[model samples]
Target: MSRILAIDYGTKRTGIAVTDELQIIASGLTTVNTKDLLQFLKDYIKNESVELFLVGEPKQMDNSASESEVHILPFITTLEKVFPKIPIQRVDERFTSKMAFQTMIDSGLKKNQRKNKALIDEISATLILQSYLYSK
Candidate 1:
Protein backbone atom coordinates (compact mmCIF):
# COMPACT_ATOMS: atom_id res chain seq x y z
CA MET A 1 0.00 0.00 0.00
CA SER A 2 1.08 3.56 -0.60
CA ARG A 3 1.78 5.88 2.28
CA ILE A 4 -0.59 8.48 3.69
CA LEU A 5 1.15 11.77 4.32
CA ALA A 6 -0.14 14.06 7.03
CA ILE A 7 0.39 17.80 7.15
CA ASP A 8 -0.02 20.22 10.01
CA TYR A 9 -0.07 23.50 8.17
CA GLY A 10 0.95 26.65 9.95
CA THR A 11 1.59 30.15 8.69
CA LYS A 12 5.33 30.11 9.27
CA ARG A 13 6.01 26.38 9.23
CA THR A 14 4.38 23.12 8.25
CA GLY A 15 4.78 19.77 9.94
CA ILE A 16 4.83 16.51 8.02
CA ALA A 17 4.28 12.87 8.92
CA VAL A 18 3.79 9.67 6.98
CA THR A 19 2.78 6.10 7.46
CA ASP A 20 4.92 3.16 6.47
CA GLU A 21 4.53 1.51 3.06
CA LEU A 22 2.01 -0.80 4.63
CA GLN A 23 0.00 2.25 5.74
CA ILE A 24 0.64 1.50 9.38
CA ILE A 25 2.92 3.09 12.04
CA ALA A 26 2.60 6.81 11.56
CA SER A 27 5.87 8.65 12.08
CA GLY A 28 7.09 12.23 12.03
CA LEU A 29 8.82 13.08 8.79
CA THR A 30 9.99 16.68 9.10
CA THR A 31 8.97 20.26 9.53
CA VAL A 32 9.49 22.69 6.69
CA ASN A 33 9.04 26.39 6.14
CA THR A 34 5.59 27.19 4.88
CA LYS A 35 6.93 28.87 1.77
CA ASP A 36 8.89 25.74 0.85
CA LEU A 37 6.11 23.25 1.50
CA LEU A 38 5.12 22.51 -2.09
CA GLN A 39 8.71 22.08 -3.16
CA PHE A 40 9.37 19.81 -0.22
CA LEU A 41 6.37 17.69 -1.09
CA LYS A 42 7.46 17.57 -4.69
CA ASP A 43 10.89 16.28 -3.81
CA TYR A 44 9.50 13.89 -1.22
CA ILE A 45 6.97 12.44 -3.61
CA LYS A 46 9.73 11.74 -6.10
CA ASN A 47 11.29 9.34 -3.60
CA GLU A 48 8.13 8.06 -1.91
CA SER A 49 4.80 6.74 -3.08
CA VAL A 50 2.13 8.80 -1.40
CA GLU A 51 -1.51 7.80 -1.83
CA LEU A 52 -3.24 10.54 0.12
CA PHE A 53 -2.75 13.90 1.79
CA LEU A 54 -4.15 14.14 5.31
CA VAL A 55 -4.24 17.78 6.30
CA GLY A 56 -5.12 19.25 9.64
CA GLU A 57 -8.25 21.39 9.79
CA PRO A 58 -8.08 23.81 12.66
CA LYS A 59 -11.47 24.53 14.18
CA GLN A 60 -12.76 26.38 17.18
CA MET A 61 -14.56 24.81 20.12
CA ASP A 62 -17.88 25.73 18.57
CA ASN A 63 -16.99 23.87 15.37
CA SER A 64 -16.33 27.03 13.36
CA ALA A 65 -13.35 27.35 11.12
CA SER A 66 -10.35 28.88 12.79
CA GLU A 67 -8.69 32.02 11.51
CA SER A 68 -5.85 29.94 10.12
CA GLU A 69 -8.27 28.20 7.76
CA VAL A 70 -7.87 31.09 5.33
CA HIS A 71 -4.20 30.23 4.93
CA ILE A 72 -4.72 26.48 4.64
CA LEU A 73 -7.55 26.76 2.12
CA PRO A 74 -5.41 28.49 -0.44
CA PHE A 75 -2.58 26.04 0.16
CA ILE A 76 -4.99 23.15 -0.28
CA THR A 77 -6.18 24.60 -3.57
CA THR A 78 -2.61 24.81 -4.75
CA LEU A 79 -1.92 21.30 -3.51
CA GLU A 80 -4.92 19.99 -5.43
CA LYS A 81 -3.69 21.69 -8.58
CA VAL A 82 -0.19 20.30 -8.13
CA PHE A 83 -1.18 16.70 -7.33
CA PRO A 84 -4.48 16.09 -9.00
CA LYS A 85 -4.50 12.33 -8.53
CA ILE A 86 -3.95 12.17 -4.76
CA PRO A 87 -7.01 12.63 -2.57
CA ILE A 88 -6.99 15.01 0.39
CA GLN A 89 -8.71 14.66 3.73
CA ARG A 90 -8.89 17.05 6.66
CA VAL A 91 -8.82 15.89 10.26
CA ASP A 92 -10.17 18.16 12.98
CA GLU A 93 -7.14 19.53 14.81
CA ARG A 94 -8.55 21.30 17.82
CA PHE A 95 -5.97 20.48 20.48
CA THR A 96 -3.09 18.79 18.76
CA SER A 97 -0.62 21.44 19.81
CA LYS A 98 -1.54 21.11 23.43
CA MET A 99 -1.35 17.38 23.09
CA ALA A 100 2.06 17.66 21.50
CA PHE A 101 3.24 19.76 24.40
CA GLN A 102 1.92 17.22 26.85
CA THR A 103 3.70 14.52 24.91
CA MET A 104 6.94 16.44 25.15
CA ILE A 105 6.55 16.71 28.87
CA ASP A 106 5.65 13.08 29.16
CA SER A 107 8.75 12.18 27.24
CA GLY A 108 10.85 14.18 29.76
CA LEU A 109 12.21 16.70 27.34
CA LYS A 110 14.19 19.55 28.82
CA LYS A 111 12.67 23.01 29.09
CA ASN A 112 14.92 24.28 26.35
CA GLN A 113 14.17 21.30 24.17
CA ARG A 114 10.47 21.73 24.78
CA LYS A 115 10.67 25.14 23.15
CA ASN A 116 11.44 23.60 19.78
CA LYS A 117 8.49 24.64 17.69
CA ALA A 118 9.54 22.43 14.82
CA LEU A 119 9.54 19.36 17.02
CA ILE A 120 6.08 20.23 18.27
CA ASP A 121 4.88 20.63 14.72
CA GLU A 122 6.28 17.26 13.75
CA ILE A 123 4.64 15.61 16.70
CA SER A 124 1.35 17.27 15.89
CA ALA A 125 1.52 15.93 12.37
CA THR A 126 2.14 12.46 13.71
CA LEU A 127 -0.86 12.85 15.97
CA ILE A 128 -2.99 13.98 13.06
CA LEU A 129 -1.97 10.96 11.01
CA GLN A 130 -2.59 8.62 13.93
CA SER A 131 -6.03 10.14 14.41
CA TYR A 132 -6.96 9.28 10.86
CA LEU A 133 -5.56 5.80 11.18
CA TYR A 134 -7.52 5.18 14.34
CA SER A 135 -10.73 6.37 12.76
CA LYS A 136 -10.28 3.89 9.97
Candidate 2:
Protein backbone atom coordinates (compact mmCIF):
# COMPACT_ATOMS: atom_id res chain seq x y z
CA MET A 1 0.00 0.00 0.00
CA SER A 2 1.05 3.58 -0.51
CA ARG A 3 2.03 5.74 2.43
CA ILE A 4 -0.50 7.79 4.33
CA LEU A 5 0.53 11.31 5.24
CA ALA A 6 -0.69 13.16 8.30
CA ILE A 7 -0.76 16.92 8.72
CA ASP A 8 -1.14 18.99 11.86
CA TYR A 9 -1.98 22.35 10.41
CA GLY A 10 -0.93 25.55 12.13
CA THR A 11 -0.89 29.16 11.07
CA LYS A 12 2.84 29.53 11.61
CA ARG A 13 4.15 26.03 11.07
CA THR A 14 2.65 22.70 9.99
CA GLY A 15 3.71 19.33 11.35
CA ILE A 16 3.95 16.29 9.14
CA ALA A 17 3.96 12.52 9.65
CA VAL A 18 3.87 9.50 7.39
CA THR A 19 3.17 5.79 7.61
CA ASP A 20 5.60 3.17 6.40
CA GLU A 21 5.12 1.65 2.95
CA LEU A 22 3.22 -1.21 4.54
CA GLN A 23 0.96 1.37 6.19
CA ILE A 24 1.65 -0.12 9.59
CA ILE A 25 3.92 2.23 11.50
CA ALA A 26 3.52 5.98 11.62
CA SER A 27 6.48 8.24 12.24
CA GLY A 28 7.07 11.95 12.56
CA LEU A 29 8.26 13.46 9.30
CA THR A 30 9.04 17.18 9.62
CA THR A 31 7.66 20.60 10.28
CA VAL A 32 7.30 23.12 7.48
CA ASN A 33 6.43 26.79 7.39
CA THR A 34 2.72 27.22 6.71
CA LYS A 35 3.45 29.53 3.78
CA ASP A 36 5.61 26.86 2.20
CA LEU A 37 3.43 23.86 3.00
CA LEU A 38 1.94 23.40 -0.44
CA GLN A 39 5.31 23.53 -2.12
CA PHE A 40 6.67 21.10 0.41
CA LEU A 41 3.88 18.66 -0.33
CA LYS A 42 4.37 19.13 -4.02
CA ASP A 43 8.00 18.22 -3.70
CA TYR A 44 7.30 15.33 -1.35
CA ILE A 45 4.63 13.74 -3.49
CA LYS A 46 6.94 13.84 -6.46
CA ASN A 47 9.12 11.26 -4.76
CA GLU A 48 6.68 9.54 -2.42
CA SER A 49 3.59 7.49 -3.17
CA VAL A 50 1.11 9.10 -0.85
CA GLU A 51 -2.38 7.60 -0.97
CA LEU A 52 -4.22 9.82 1.48
CA PHE A 53 -3.93 12.96 3.56
CA LEU A 54 -4.89 12.57 7.21
CA VAL A 55 -5.52 16.04 8.66
CA GLY A 56 -6.14 16.99 12.25
CA GLU A 57 -9.59 18.39 13.04
CA PRO A 58 -9.49 20.70 16.01
CA LYS A 59 -12.47 20.80 18.37
CA GLN A 60 -13.35 22.53 21.62
CA MET A 61 -14.54 21.08 24.92
CA ASP A 62 -18.14 21.71 23.86
CA ASN A 63 -17.46 19.44 20.84
CA SER A 64 -18.03 22.35 18.48
CA ALA A 65 -15.43 23.15 15.88
CA SER A 66 -12.56 25.24 17.16
CA GLU A 67 -11.82 28.73 15.85
CA SER A 68 -8.67 27.42 14.24
CA GLU A 69 -10.89 25.44 11.87
CA VAL A 70 -11.29 28.61 9.86
CA HIS A 71 -7.62 28.58 8.95
CA ILE A 72 -7.69 24.86 8.27
CA LEU A 73 -10.65 24.87 5.93
CA PRO A 74 -8.85 26.94 3.35
CA PHE A 75 -5.88 24.65 3.51
CA ILE A 76 -8.13 21.64 3.04
CA THR A 77 -9.65 23.24 -0.02
CA THR A 78 -6.19 23.79 -1.39
CA LEU A 79 -5.27 20.18 -0.70
CA GLU A 80 -8.28 18.95 -2.60
CA LYS A 81 -7.36 21.16 -5.51
CA VAL A 82 -3.66 20.42 -5.62
CA PHE A 83 -3.71 16.72 -4.82
CA PRO A 84 -6.96 15.82 -6.49
CA LYS A 85 -6.38 12.08 -6.41
CA ILE A 86 -5.43 11.71 -2.78
CA PRO A 87 -8.42 11.73 -0.43
CA ILE A 88 -8.35 13.69 2.82
CA GLN A 89 -9.67 12.55 6.19
CA ARG A 90 -9.98 14.50 9.44
CA VAL A 91 -9.37 13.15 12.95
CA ASP A 92 -10.27 14.82 16.23
CA GLU A 93 -7.21 16.68 17.52
CA ARG A 94 -8.39 17.88 20.91
CA PHE A 95 -5.61 18.03 23.52
CA THR A 96 -2.93 16.85 21.09
CA SER A 97 -0.62 19.70 22.04
CA LYS A 98 -0.86 18.86 25.72
CA MET A 99 -0.37 15.20 24.94
CA ALA A 100 2.69 15.92 22.84
CA PHE A 101 4.21 17.96 25.61
CA GLN A 102 3.59 15.20 28.09
CA THR A 103 5.17 12.70 25.69
CA MET A 104 8.26 14.87 25.53
CA ILE A 105 8.51 14.85 29.32
CA ASP A 106 7.89 11.10 29.50
CA SER A 107 10.63 10.54 26.96
CA GLY A 108 13.09 12.46 29.19
CA LEU A 109 13.46 15.56 27.09
CA LYS A 110 15.35 18.33 28.86
CA LYS A 111 13.71 21.65 29.69
CA ASN A 112 15.40 23.26 26.71
CA GLN A 113 14.44 20.56 24.20
CA ARG A 114 10.86 20.51 25.41
CA LYS A 115 10.60 24.18 24.62
CA ASN A 116 10.69 23.44 20.88
CA LYS A 117 7.19 24.03 19.55
CA ALA A 118 8.13 22.59 16.18
CA LEU A 119 8.99 19.27 17.76
CA ILE A 120 5.67 19.28 19.57
CA ASP A 121 3.86 19.79 16.30
CA GLU A 122 5.70 16.90 14.67
CA ILE A 123 4.84 14.61 17.55
CA SER A 124 1.23 15.73 17.39
CA ALA A 125 1.11 14.74 13.74
CA THR A 126 2.55 11.35 14.62
CA LEU A 127 -0.13 10.90 17.25
CA ILE A 128 -2.84 11.79 14.78
CA LEU A 129 -1.53 9.29 12.25
CA GLN A 130 -1.11 6.55 14.84
CA SER A 131 -4.63 7.11 16.10
CA TYR A 132 -5.98 6.66 12.60
CA LEU A 133 -3.94 3.56 11.99
CA TYR A 134 -5.14 1.91 15.18
CA SER A 135 -8.74 2.82 14.47
CA LYS A 136 -8.52 0.70 11.36
Candidate 3:
Protein backbone atom coordinates (compact mmCIF):
# COMPACT_ATOMS: atom_id res chain seq x y z
CA MET A 1 0.00 0.00 0.00
CA SER A 2 1.11 3.55 -0.63
CA ARG A 3 2.06 5.75 2.28
CA ILE A 4 0.52 9.04 3.30
CA LEU A 5 2.74 12.10 3.53
CA ALA A 6 2.12 15.16 5.66
CA ILE A 7 3.64 18.62 5.47
CA ASP A 8 3.86 21.42 7.99
CA TYR A 9 4.66 24.37 5.78
CA GLY A 10 6.44 27.39 7.13
CA THR A 11 7.80 30.50 5.46
CA LYS A 12 11.44 29.52 5.75
CA ARG A 13 11.29 25.78 6.41
CA THR A 14 8.94 22.87 5.96
CA GLY A 15 8.42 19.80 8.12
CA ILE A 16 7.72 16.45 6.53
CA ALA A 17 6.25 13.21 7.89
CA VAL A 18 5.12 9.89 6.47
CA THR A 19 3.34 6.76 7.43
CA ASP A 20 4.70 3.31 6.76
CA GLU A 21 3.59 1.42 3.69
CA LEU A 22 1.10 -0.38 5.88
CA GLN A 23 -0.32 3.05 6.78
CA ILE A 24 0.52 2.63 10.43
CA ILE A 25 2.59 4.89 12.66
CA ALA A 26 3.37 8.42 11.55
CA SER A 27 7.00 9.40 11.80
CA GLY A 28 8.92 12.55 11.16
CA LEU A 29 10.75 12.46 7.85
CA THR A 30 12.77 15.68 7.83
CA THR A 31 12.84 19.42 7.81
CA VAL A 32 13.75 21.14 4.56
CA ASN A 33 14.17 24.66 3.32
CA THR A 34 10.89 25.88 1.87
CA LYS A 35 12.57 26.79 -1.42
CA ASP A 36 13.75 23.20 -1.84
CA LEU A 37 10.51 21.46 -0.91
CA LEU A 38 9.24 20.75 -4.41
CA GLN A 39 12.46 19.16 -5.53
CA PHE A 40 12.64 17.22 -2.34
CA LEU A 41 9.14 15.84 -2.84
CA LYS A 42 9.96 14.92 -6.43
CA ASP A 43 12.93 12.93 -5.25
CA TYR A 44 10.96 11.31 -2.43
CA ILE A 45 8.10 10.28 -4.71
CA LYS A 46 10.56 8.58 -6.97
CA ASN A 47 11.49 6.25 -4.11
CA GLU A 48 8.19 5.95 -2.25
CA SER A 49 4.60 5.48 -3.26
CA VAL A 50 2.72 8.45 -1.83
CA GLU A 51 -1.05 8.05 -1.84
CA LEU A 52 -1.92 11.52 -0.56
CA PHE A 53 -0.52 14.77 0.75
CA LEU A 54 -1.85 16.06 4.06
CA VAL A 55 -1.01 19.73 4.45
CA GLY A 56 -1.33 21.58 7.72
CA GLU A 57 -3.84 24.39 7.42
CA PRO A 58 -2.86 27.13 9.77
CA LYS A 59 -5.73 28.91 11.49
CA GLN A 60 -6.21 31.51 14.19
CA MET A 61 -7.99 31.03 17.53
CA ASP A 62 -11.19 32.27 15.93
CA ASN A 63 -10.90 29.58 13.22
CA SER A 64 -10.09 32.12 10.55
CA ALA A 65 -7.33 31.42 8.08
CA SER A 66 -4.02 32.50 9.44
CA GLU A 67 -1.68 34.84 7.59
CA SER A 68 0.53 31.92 6.75
CA GLU A 69 -2.22 30.56 4.53
CA VAL A 70 -1.41 33.31 2.05
CA HIS A 71 1.89 31.58 1.44
CA ILE A 72 0.56 28.03 1.79
CA LEU A 73 -2.23 28.52 -0.72
CA PRO A 74 0.23 29.30 -3.49
CA PHE A 75 2.33 26.32 -2.55
CA ILE A 76 -0.73 24.08 -2.61
CA THR A 77 -1.64 25.36 -6.05
CA THR A 78 1.81 24.55 -7.33
CA LEU A 79 1.76 21.19 -5.65
CA GLU A 80 -1.50 20.31 -7.39
CA LYS A 81 -0.06 21.32 -10.74
CA VAL A 82 3.01 19.21 -10.13
CA PHE A 83 1.39 16.14 -8.59
CA PRO A 84 -2.08 16.01 -10.02
CA LYS A 85 -2.29 12.28 -9.52
CA ILE A 86 -2.00 12.49 -5.75
CA PRO A 87 -4.82 14.02 -3.71
CA ILE A 88 -4.22 16.81 -1.24
CA GLN A 89 -6.08 17.40 2.02
CA ARG A 90 -5.80 20.06 4.67
CA VAL A 91 -5.65 19.26 8.40
CA ASP A 92 -6.22 21.92 11.01
CA GLU A 93 -2.86 23.01 12.42
CA ARG A 94 -3.86 25.25 15.28
CA PHE A 95 -1.49 25.08 18.26
CA THR A 96 0.74 22.54 16.58
CA SER A 97 3.89 24.52 17.25
CA LYS A 98 3.01 24.96 20.88
CA MET A 99 2.14 21.28 21.11
CA ALA A 100 5.42 20.38 19.52
CA PHE A 101 7.26 22.45 22.11
CA GLN A 102 5.38 20.73 24.89
CA THR A 103 6.14 17.37 23.36
CA MET A 104 9.81 18.23 23.37
CA ILE A 105 9.57 19.15 27.04
CA ASP A 106 7.79 15.89 27.81
CA SER A 107 10.46 13.99 25.91
CA GLY A 108 13.04 15.57 28.20
CA LEU A 109 14.93 17.31 25.45
CA LYS A 110 17.49 19.77 26.70
CA LYS A 111 17.09 23.48 26.26
CA ASN A 112 19.50 23.57 23.32
CA GLN A 113 17.76 20.69 21.60
CA ARG A 114 14.35 22.19 22.20
CA LYS A 115 15.56 25.39 20.61
CA ASN A 116 15.98 23.67 17.24
CA LYS A 117 13.23 25.10 15.12
CA ALA A 118 13.77 22.44 12.48
CA LEU A 119 13.16 19.69 15.02
CA ILE A 120 10.02 21.36 16.23
CA ASP A 121 8.78 21.67 12.69
CA GLU A 122 9.47 18.01 12.05
CA ILE A 123 7.62 17.00 15.21
CA SER A 124 4.71 19.24 14.27
CA ALA A 125 4.47 17.47 10.93
CA THR A 126 4.43 14.15 12.69
CA LEU A 127 1.66 15.39 14.95
CA ILE A 128 -0.33 16.52 11.95
CA LEU A 129 0.09 13.16 10.30
CA GLN A 130 -0.91 11.34 13.45
CA SER A 131 -3.98 13.51 13.75
CA TYR A 132 -4.96 12.70 10.17
CA LEU A 133 -4.53 9.02 10.82
CA TYR A 134 -6.73 9.19 13.88
CA SER A 135 -9.38 11.09 12.00
CA LYS A 136 -9.51 8.33 9.44
Candidate 4:
Protein backbone atom coordinates (compact mmCIF):
# COMPACT_ATOMS: atom_id res chain seq x y z
CA MET A 1 0.00 0.00 0.00
CA SER A 2 1.09 3.55 -0.67
CA ARG A 3 2.21 5.53 2.34
CA ILE A 4 0.69 8.78 3.56
CA LEU A 5 2.91 11.87 3.82
CA ALA A 6 2.47 14.81 6.15
CA ILE A 7 3.88 18.34 6.12
CA ASP A 8 4.30 21.04 8.72
CA TYR A 9 4.88 24.19 6.75
CA GLY A 10 6.67 27.18 8.16
CA THR A 11 7.79 30.44 6.62
CA LYS A 12 11.44 29.52 6.36
CA ARG A 13 11.35 25.79 6.91
CA THR A 14 9.03 22.88 6.27
CA GLY A 15 8.85 19.59 8.16
CA ILE A 16 7.96 16.28 6.56
CA ALA A 17 6.76 12.90 7.82
CA VAL A 18 5.53 9.65 6.38
CA THR A 19 3.68 6.55 7.47
CA ASP A 20 5.09 3.06 7.27
CA GLU A 21 4.21 0.92 4.27
CA LEU A 22 1.48 -0.73 6.30
CA GLN A 23 0.30 2.73 7.43
CA ILE A 24 0.50 1.76 11.07
CA ILE A 25 3.05 4.27 12.30
CA ALA A 26 4.18 7.77 11.48
CA SER A 27 7.78 8.87 11.48
CA GLY A 28 9.58 12.11 10.86
CA LEU A 29 11.15 12.24 7.45
CA THR A 30 13.10 15.52 7.15
CA THR A 31 13.01 19.25 7.36
CA VAL A 32 13.63 21.30 4.25
CA ASN A 33 13.84 24.94 3.28
CA THR A 34 10.47 26.35 2.34
CA LYS A 35 11.85 27.50 -0.99
CA ASP A 36 12.94 23.97 -1.86
CA LEU A 37 9.82 22.13 -0.71
CA LEU A 38 8.26 21.56 -4.09
CA GLN A 39 11.38 20.09 -5.57
CA PHE A 40 11.88 18.02 -2.47
CA LEU A 41 8.42 16.49 -2.74
CA LYS A 42 8.91 15.85 -6.43
CA ASP A 43 12.10 13.96 -5.76
CA TYR A 44 10.53 12.05 -2.89
CA ILE A 45 7.48 10.96 -4.86
CA LYS A 46 9.70 9.64 -7.61
CA ASN A 47 11.18 7.09 -5.24
CA GLU A 48 8.19 6.35 -3.03
CA SER A 49 4.50 5.95 -3.65
CA VAL A 50 2.43 8.31 -1.54
CA GLU A 51 -1.33 7.92 -1.40
CA LEU A 52 -2.11 11.17 0.37
CA PHE A 53 -0.55 14.43 1.53
CA LEU A 54 -1.58 15.81 4.91
CA VAL A 55 -0.71 19.46 5.47
CA GLY A 56 -1.00 21.07 8.86
CA GLU A 57 -3.56 23.85 9.05
CA PRO A 58 -2.85 26.45 11.66
CA LYS A 59 -6.07 27.83 13.09
CA GLN A 60 -6.73 30.47 15.73
CA MET A 61 -8.35 29.84 19.10
CA ASP A 62 -11.71 30.85 17.69
CA ASN A 63 -11.27 28.29 14.93
CA SER A 64 -10.72 30.94 12.31
CA ALA A 65 -7.82 30.93 9.92
CA SER A 66 -4.61 31.86 11.66
CA GLU A 67 -2.18 34.46 10.43
CA SER A 68 0.09 31.76 9.09
CA GLU A 69 -2.71 30.70 6.78
CA VAL A 70 -1.79 33.60 4.49
CA HIS A 71 1.48 31.86 3.71
CA ILE A 72 0.14 28.31 3.87
CA LEU A 73 -2.73 28.90 1.50
CA PRO A 74 -0.42 29.87 -1.32
CA PHE A 75 1.81 26.92 -0.66
CA ILE A 76 -1.17 24.60 -0.72
CA THR A 77 -2.20 25.97 -4.09
CA THR A 78 1.25 25.41 -5.44
CA LEU A 79 1.38 21.95 -3.96
CA GLU A 80 -1.90 21.02 -5.63
CA LYS A 81 -0.67 22.29 -8.95
CA VAL A 82 2.61 20.50 -8.63
CA PHE A 83 1.26 17.15 -7.44
CA PRO A 84 -2.28 16.95 -8.68
CA LYS A 85 -2.25 13.20 -8.66
CA ILE A 86 -1.76 12.93 -4.90
CA PRO A 87 -4.80 13.85 -2.80
CA ILE A 88 -4.21 16.58 -0.24
CA GLN A 89 -5.87 17.12 3.14
CA ARG A 90 -5.42 19.42 6.12
CA VAL A 91 -5.15 18.50 9.78
CA ASP A 92 -5.64 21.03 12.58
CA GLU A 93 -2.24 22.01 13.96
CA ARG A 94 -3.18 24.13 16.93
CA PHE A 95 -0.39 23.15 19.30
CA THR A 96 1.84 20.78 17.40
CA SER A 97 4.91 22.92 18.02
CA LYS A 98 4.34 23.07 21.74
CA MET A 99 3.60 19.37 21.72
CA ALA A 100 6.78 18.73 19.82
CA PHE A 101 8.76 20.64 22.42
CA GLN A 102 7.12 18.71 25.20
CA THR A 103 7.85 15.50 23.37
CA MET A 104 11.51 16.45 23.10
CA ILE A 105 11.63 17.17 26.79
CA ASP A 106 9.96 13.90 27.61
CA SER A 107 12.41 12.04 25.35
CA GLY A 108 15.36 13.47 27.35
CA LEU A 109 16.81 15.49 24.50
CA LYS A 110 19.54 17.88 25.54
CA LYS A 111 18.87 21.59 25.58
CA ASN A 112 20.94 22.15 22.45
CA GLN A 113 19.09 19.44 20.58
CA ARG A 114 15.74 20.75 21.78
CA LYS A 115 16.66 24.16 20.48
CA ASN A 116 17.02 22.87 16.93
CA LYS A 117 14.10 24.38 15.01
CA ALA A 118 14.48 21.78 12.27
CA LEU A 119 13.99 18.99 14.79
CA ILE A 120 10.92 20.70 16.15
CA ASP A 121 9.51 20.99 12.69
CA GLU A 122 10.13 17.34 11.97
CA ILE A 123 8.39 16.37 15.21
CA SER A 124 5.47 18.62 14.38
CA ALA A 125 5.11 16.90 11.05
CA THR A 126 5.11 13.54 12.72
CA LEU A 127 2.44 14.71 15.11
CA ILE A 128 0.35 15.93 12.22
CA LEU A 129 0.66 12.55 10.51
CA GLN A 130 -0.25 10.71 13.69
CA SER A 131 -3.26 12.92 14.17
CA TYR A 132 -4.43 12.10 10.68
CA LEU A 133 -3.94 8.42 11.21
CA TYR A 134 -5.93 8.46 14.42
CA SER A 135 -8.76 10.36 12.77
CA LYS A 136 -8.98 7.70 10.12
Per-model TM-score on C-alpha atoms: 0.99, 0.99, 0.99, 0.98
Per-candidate local distance difference test: 0.97, 0.97, 0.98, 0.96
Could you give candidate 2's per-residue lDDT for residues 9-85 as a string of tens digits? 99999999999999999999999999999999999999999999999999999999999999999999999999999
Expressed as tens digits, the lDDT of each residue in 25-46 for candidate 4 is: 9999999999999999999999
The sequence of per-residue lDDT tens digits that candidate 1 reaches over residues 52-117 is 999999999999999999999999999999999999999999899999999999999999999999
Over 4 Å off in model 3, which ranges? none
TM-score for candidate 4, please give it.
Answer: 0.98
**On a 0 to 100 scale, what is the lDDT of residue 2 in model 3?**
99
Error of 4 at 103 (Å): 0.4
Model 3 is weakest, by summed lDDT over 10 consecutive residues, at: 59-68
lDDT of 1 at 112: 99
- Clash pairs of candidate 4? none
**How many steric overlaps are in each model, in order?**
0, 0, 0, 0
Worst 10 residues of 2 by lDDT: 91-100
What candidate 4 gets wrong by more than 4 Å, as runs, is none
